[model samples]
Target: VHHGNGTEEILGSDSRFLFISSHTRGQAFYPGTGAESWKNVLNVPLSLGFSADDFLREWSEAGVPGRIAAFQPQLIILSAGFDAHRDDPALGGRLETEDFLRLTEHMVSLAWGIESCHGRLLSVLEGGYDTSVPTPHRQRGGALQRSVEAHLKGLVSSSRLPSNFTSSVLGKRKKPQCGSIASV
Candidate 1:
């Protein structure tokens, strides 16, 4: 989710793909892009200490689900970056492990809504470099393990959830007015 500029640069404006990213926004951040001026890229830039609630709100405001529905992507590629987790010191964003699950669930629901998607989702881990020495309460690998496990479990749970469940959750929401794009 952090610094998806390269992907956006590659696919942005090419209606065949819809590029969406949620990341820290500031001139100080690395690869300082994802600004509001970027066209064809749905960038949800947030300040430091952004929590899961903030993330979800931003996602909804950005009309992510409607964008997905409009695009009707045949497949979804998630550049999963866990460095945004509060425990990870590499990035300043304060997302917790459970936040990842919620985000995954939203994406899964979006995938389920589109006929072409058919739940075709691929998650490729990108960041998270908190692997260091161990402590009494927590270990170097523990956070990574927990985050990965949570993501996997969330995906499984999302897949098992009834289609009606997704409809029930998303049905009340109004359709976004954003334009559609071609399939990736």
Candidate 2:
């Protein structure tokens, strides 16, 4: 139940209230932000890896209800990111897009508990440098684009699935958990 747009007009009567945003400062990517304020901001200009667990923990502490709670949200719009993927060249986030799916599922579960926002969630594209790098390997930005596309496709499929999907995927594979400061 979060929308990132800075415009008060978009929210109608609900404008200026309950809306939150966390985005890069300048127009480093597409959909430039004219926003002047943000309720929750993780403002790291270029690269700052936002780990899934970190997001969950911070959000949980933000006083909002857990991911699975019955709340009435007009709509929950997520600003999806693929640059955080471990493979992306633009960012050093190192987050697997699956983490994004898990987060999405978490929000969706919360919505399901509430009769108001059950199916009213809306997701909007924000920033992802994975799609437009300039190089030979980035022919038409195909290499990273394809990988991100695959990752996003996987995320979509996973979102439709149950939360056990995350447990199952992580259960089969084991990888070191590293925390790095640089975004890339």
Full-model lDDT for every candidate: 0.72, 0.48
Q: Which stretches of candidate 1 lie over 4 Å from their true place?
A: 37-39, 132-140, 158-160, 163-184
lDDT tens digits, residue span 91-127, model 2: 5454665676566666656654565554445665654
| Model 1 TM-score (2 dp) | 0.78
Please give the clash total of every predicted structure, in order. Answer: 0, 2
Best by TM-score: 1
lDDT of 1 by residue, 114-178 (tens): 88887778998877767545577654454555566567666667354555654654577533221
How does model 2 score by TM-score?
Answer: 0.51
What are the RMSDs of all candidates, in order? 9.4, 10.2
